[model samples]
Target: MATAGGGNAHMVFRRYLDAVGLQGLASAEAAGLHTSEWYALSLITLEGSLSSGELASRTGLTTGATTRLIDRLERAGYARRAADPHDRRRVI
Candidate 1:
């Protein structure tokens, strides 16, 4: 019989797979979205509008990589960064 920890681990793995499967379906439905775009979208949905730096942190992306993701999102009309309300030096 599986121990409680083993059972929990199995459930966790199943949950992860389920989430991945859903993401895959969503990505396929999106005309131009691949895994990276999906990842960025998921982060934006969960975290709301963020500066490029903040978006990078939430998505586990480097600044350059995040910029690429933002470009994709912008092209796809999924995201945009507004100028920071308090700081004119940045977009959020």
Candidate 2:
């Protein structure tokens, strides 16, 4: 049996999830992008800029998936990849 506080916490968590899902859906639709793309864009915006590895870790996506996501964003004009200034071998 769950306590009232536990039930309330569950409700709050559910509502938060719903709100976040709706916002992500709406934003993706507005941008003519997939939800994952929008999510990646949001992460990039929050982080300013991140390398593919960093993005993968942050988003829980594999490196290959992150590469594809970045490719999509770049093709859609939502993102760009640039060489890291300090590290010639890295991209950001």
Name the top lDDT candidate.
2
lDDT of each: 0.82, 0.91
The segments of candidate 2 whose C-alpha lies over 4 angstroms from its true place after superposition are 1-5
TM-scores for every predicted model: 0.71, 0.83
Instruction: Find the 10 residues in a row with the least total lDDT in model 2.
Output: 1-10
TM-score of 2: 0.83
TM-score of 1: 0.71
Per-residue C-alpha lDDT of model 1 across residues 1-92, encoded as one tens digit per residue: 55566587789898999998997877746656877778778777887778889888877889999998899888889888788888999897
Clashing pairs in 1: none
What lDDT does candidate 2 reach at residue 86?
92
* Residue pairs whose backbone atoms clash in candidate 2: none
Give model 2's clash tally: 0
User: 7-82 in candidate 2: lDDT tens per residue?
Assistant: 7778889899999999889989999998888888999998888999999998899999999999999999989999
